[model samples]
Target chain A: MTPYDIILTVLTTLLALYLISFALYIVRVLKGPTIPDRVLALDSLGYDLAAFMLILSIYLNSPMMAVCALSLALWIYALDIYVAKYLEAKEVGG
Target chain B: MSEMLPVIMAFVAALISIVATWLAVQERDMLIATLFSALQSTCYALIYYLLMAPDIVLVYLPVSVGILPLITIILIKKTERYEE
Candidate 1:
């Protein structure tokens, strides 16, 4: 087995692990007993997905796809702030 | 295995997306449902990336993951948290 094959195997294994956790996160999102629980799961899923995108870019052999990971990382935080304020019964925004 | 890694990843992501959509609609709480919608959007964005459509991911991330959830949560606050 060459070194390149070893690298590909490791990447595929990691990607499989991420996908498995992704499914587990979905289960948590589904069976969550509270709104906050569900929101928290969703938050983790977003960030996890961004990481998946980065890995995918590497697998795809393209640096351009990394930009999606960057923007996706930036955006999901808005959901957290909005939900927290709404739960606290405070003004969400102007 | 190396040759088909992207295709396999995309398939798994697609399945997750379907499950997320089902969970989102099945929720009794609007807030939780909205959160699930965000998850669904996230899966879609990943699918976009897997399909090599970075441009779509750019628009989808901000609009679907960011703005859509924010607006929906605000509307939920104004309406009702739990559905009857």
Candidate 2:
């Protein structure tokens, strides 16, 4: 096999493992007992997904996927901040 | 083969972050989980750089590494719900 093929194989294997972890994170998000727990899982999922997209770009030799990563990063930050603020308000109201 | 090492490193780092994320989920304390989340973000930033997206790395590193954790920590402190 060519060196590129070997590299691609290894990278794909790692990506598969990441996808499994991503699925596990989804389970945690669903089963989380608290809002923060769900948010945390969601945050991790976003980051992992961004990484996945970036890796896929490398594998596909496309630069456009990096923009997807950038967007994910921006959206996740906003979502996490909003969730934290909402949780704070809930706690204060109690 | 040598030229592809950076990609390999990036993949391994992503793997590490995934394992860390798994551990974070298993943690019973929210604060610790949040810390892991931050670490996961840092790893992702490295992966972004490795993928030749320095622009994305620059934009996200600060937001994920700086802002998100600060907000989460503040919320945790305010609510006093560090433990699950």
Candidate 3:
């Protein structure tokens, strides 16, 4: 096989593995019993998604997609912080 | 060979993240799960780097690894409730 073929196969395999992990993270987010647990799962899933986006950019040799990944990572952080603060306030008041 | 190194690193990081997610879900304690979630972020940062996106990694690593964890810990502290 050619070198390109070998590299392509490896990249595809790795991407597939990452996708499976992402699916598992989704299950955790759905099944989490507590709010904190769900938040944690969501946080993990966000990070994984960022990684996945980066990998896709590399696989496709597109630099523009990396910009999207950067923005998404930043957005998720804000969401996580906001949700955590809201949860804390609710817990304190109740 | 050198170009393929990034793919190899990405593969390793992805595997680490998968295992960490599994452990986070299996752990009963929310605090431990949060810690695992933070670990997953670190692995993801490495994966991002492997994908040749230093800019994205820079933004992601600190927020996911630092800010998110601190916020989660604070929420946990205020709640004082571990289980459902």
Best prediction by lDDT: 1
Can you give the DockQ of every candidate in the order shown? 0.83, 0.05, 0.05
Error of 1 at A69 (Å): 0.8
Off by over 4 Å in 3: A91-94, B1-84
State which candidate, 1 or 3, has the greater DockQ. 1
Residue-wise C-alpha lDDT for candidate 2, range A7-69, written one tens digit per residue: 988986786687679668866765677767877887887778778778877876777556757
Least accurate stretch of 10 residues (summed lDDT) in model 1 chain B?
Answer: B1-10
- How good is the docking of model 3, as DockQ? 0.05
Interface RMSD of 1: 1.1
Candidate 3 clashes: the total is 0
Error of 2 at B74 (Å): 20
Task: Compose the digit string of candidate 1's lDDT tens values, residues B6-81.
Answer: 7877787788778878877887877777877887788788778878899988998899988888788778767767
User: Candidate 1's C-alpha lDDT?
Assistant: 0.81
lDDT tens string, model 1, A1-94?
A: 9998788788888988888888888788878887788878888988888888888778778997798888987888888888888867755453
Looking at the true structure's interface, with contacts defined as alpha carbon pairs within 8 Å between chains A and B, what fraction does model 3 recover? 0.00
Candidate 2 vs candidate 3, TM-score winner: 2
Which sections of candidate 2 miss by over 4 Å?
Answer: B1-84
A1-94: candidate 3 lDDT, tens digit per residue: 9998888779888977886786687567656777677667777777677777777777777776576567557756765675567567777974
The CA lDDT of each predicted structure is 0.81, 0.72, 0.71
